[model samples]
Target chain A: MEPLLSCENVSFSYENTAVIKNLSFHVNSGDYLCIVGENGSGKSTLTKGLLGLKAPAEGKIIRGSDLHGNEIGYLPQQNPAQKDFPASVFEVVLSGRLNSRRFRPFYSKEDKKIARENLKKLGIEDLIKRSYRDLSGGQQQRVLLARALCAGSKLLFLDEPVTGLDPIVTEEMYKLILELNRKEKITIIMVSHDIKASVLYATHILHLNFDKSFFGRTEDYIKSPMGKYFFSE
Target chain B: MFNFAEMFQYSFMLRALIGGILISLCAALLGVSLVLKRYSMIGDGLSHVGFGALAIGSAANFSPLEFSIPIVILSAFFLLRISENSKIKGDAAIALISTSALAIGITAASLSGVNTDIDNYLFGSILSLSRSDLVICIIVFIVVMILFILFYNKIFAVTFDESFAKANGTRVGIYNMLIALLTALTIVIGMKLMGTLLISSLIIFPAIISMRICRRFKTVIIMSSIVSVVGFFAGLVISYNRSTPAGASVVLVNLAMLIVFYVIGTVSDKIKAKKFLKQ
Candidate 1:
């Protein structure tokens, strides 16, 4: 079977200066792929490209025949503005079903059921009525994760999900993501700066560097020179 | 002493009340999204554009409402485009457009030598709302209401997070344009009663005041609409009794409501904090 998503010689640039050049990678179903890179390594641009927010300057990104463009669940980095936003957990999660609603003005009963089920899946059912802004950071991330699950069940793209989180919460978050991949067989493409944790949790690793990039199984990546050098640093 | 029965006796007063209340409802509904999106001043900028359009229309011997409607709507789209794609930020873009429009309007009114009642346009004269204007106000109000109800969820999603909304294929641009279009319509109709200067208060105050106490978006929207309508009514009553300007008095009433809501929110927060400490 074809991989879930494949990028062929993809290049992205800002104002004629290339950030990601001739990058190629593929993500298969049930794969936990960690994209590790330093600052300004085009990780953000690549994330935008994969999410269909930005088109590659060269080459193409192909989704699986079964996966529609909007079917990819995306949990973007939390912006400061959203920290003080006024919305209930239920409302935030329910909004993730917007694509499923299509032409319908309001969410249907089935949509509401899916939202509740996702909340329950993430063990955040009790937070349904709570104000989203008032929740602790860990709880907020969980709520957002539940929201992402509501958007798409098969593929998830998380952008630095553990950023700003305490070490314990970060470990918990990583465990939760691992559980989703192992039990639910969900495909996860996580972009992170934490190469240590990324190597520990991810089944596959895509290390993006300014001049050189590597993509392979986690074991092979750990043996690769780039990975060894990164660990040494 | 204010005479409740006699206030409704005059036909012009009734027209003002009906038109003012309807515009207030529409403004408040759209204002919640605008305030949250940090586009609160778009109303003020668009109203200034409407003033310029009205001045040019009057000078050209055209129907002010018909001519200004399309122009103001176009400016709304232009404002959105430049703000998104250009280097100019949102507030700066609004300021640029509004000041230019105001300057052009003032120059055009003076150059035409039509002896227009510019003060009425600047400060608003509620009693000057003609029957035809009132009819237009009613139609716009209905359209705004229906569209708002139909797209409420999409609007909420867009306001809360534009990137997430777009990622889910929510067509964030279209919803944003829809908001801009509705705000333009509301500002134009409201400018006749609230004036170019004070019209944005109708769009800003209600949303901000309701947000003081409402923790949820739905409640914020509902409370905003209620506050706007009640404040408009009370302002009309006070203006009628004291013989004050309708626009200024309505804004004053909204300000008073804001203070009241602020106090209530603070008190409730203190009570909740105390209970938490006790526990």
Candidate 2:
């Protein structure tokens, strides 16, 4: 199958220091690939480059064979701005519906209907009118995920998606991701710091160790000596 | 050249004064989102762009508002697009567009030999506004007020988070572009009374003051409008007393309010801390 996204020898630097070097990888349709690394290991930087939020100083990112903005949705780690912004949840979700078509002509009531359906699907339709800033971390994460889903995206990108959740909620979050992947055949690429927990949910793993990488099936990696060295289990 | 009393006595000055009040109301209303989103620079930058466009419009024998309106809108749109890509910091992009437009405008005015009227654009002439300018200002002010009332939810949503907005299917780009267009309109119409250099003060100063004093979003907006209108009245009175420019005096009055609010917020915090120790 044609890969959705391919990065060949992708590299980036900040002033004199290199953050990512000669990093090359690919993601395919219906693949839930979780990237694991320590802080400053370039996980977030890699995702940012993929989303076109940042420009890599060197290397190339070939997209749409795997995913594009229209086909890819992202849930950023921190929405520090959303705290002071006074917008309702309903309005927040509607913004995801953008990039569908320009000039709209007349908004299909159908799209609005789908947005509502997505909110309900995330089990937070009751919080639809509340200020986005008021929600708890878990709820906000769910809301943001729903918003990402509203884009009709076939692939989802989540960065540190379970950072502040309780164990049960984290379990539920993983369950939800699995459900989406299983039911909708949607591809998910996530940058997760939780090495052990994420292993349960991820189908494939892209393990980055500064200048080198281990890319293959997650189960195989768990049995590999490198995984034991890194995860120590 | 209208005389001071003649300017005061004529219905036109009265209309301009009232027009300034209305336009300033729109500025204060929009300022909440602008300040909170840290896009007060968007207003400031676009207003400067409008100033340049206004100068060229007058020098080239075209309608200043006509030339200014589109260019201001385009700059606002560009700012929004740049913001989404996040290639450069939003503040940096705002500064780049803001200064470039101002430079272009200065060059255009110099080349056209219209330096004499530049002061009117930079430091608005309250005594000489035309009847048509007054009417258009009022119309633009009303249109701005109505759009805010109608689209407050969508505007609030996108300003808070563009991606979250896009994910929810709210036409994030269109709404963002629309906001830029609205901001450009406010700046263009407002330039007639407040001038380019000082008008953004009407949006930002009120917000800075309100955010310092008010706790809730509703309270913040109300306080901003109140602070602004009061500054207008106080400035007009001082301008009359000092025989100075009304627009410039108004800006000084805004600066004064900022100082007062900063002191009050600081003192209040000190008082609360002292009470906590006593308890």
Candidate number achieving the greatest lDDT relative to the actual structure: 1
Candidate 1: regions farther than 4 A off: B114-116
Residue-by-residue lDDT tens digits, candidate 1, B1-279? 668789999999999999999999999999999888878777889999999888877877788889999999999898887767747687887898899999988888899895445677888987779999999999999999999999999999899888888888888999999999999999998998999899999999999999899989999999999999999999999999999999999999999999999999999999999998999
- How far in Å is the alpha carbon of B277 misplaced in model 1? 2.1
Deviation from native of the Cα of residue A79 in model 2, angstroms: 4.1
What global local distance difference test value does model 2 have?
0.77
- Determine which window of 10 residues in candidate 2 chain B has minimal summed lDDT: B162-171
Estimate, for each residue in A1-233, the C-alpha lDDT of model 1 and write its tens digit.
Answer: 79999999999997678998888999999999999988989999899899888899999999998888689888989988788778899999998898888888999899999999999988889999999878989899999998899899999999999999999999999999999999999999999999999999999999997547999999999889988887776
The best candidate by TM-score is 1
Could you give candidate 2's per-residue lDDT for residues A1-233 as a string of tens digits? Answer: 78888788888775567878898888888899999888887887787688766678888988864354555677867567665444467766765665463444323677678779989888889988876666777777887788778775688888888887899888888888888888888889889988887688888998877677777898988877768786674
CAPRI band of model 1? medium
Reported per model, the fraction of native interface contacts reproduced equals: 0.71, 0.18
lDDT of 1 at A31: 98
Return the lDDT, model 1, position B199. 95
* Candidate 2 deviant stretches above 4 angstroms: A1-75, A79-158, A162-190, A200-221, A224-226, B1-9, B88-100, B107-115, B267-279
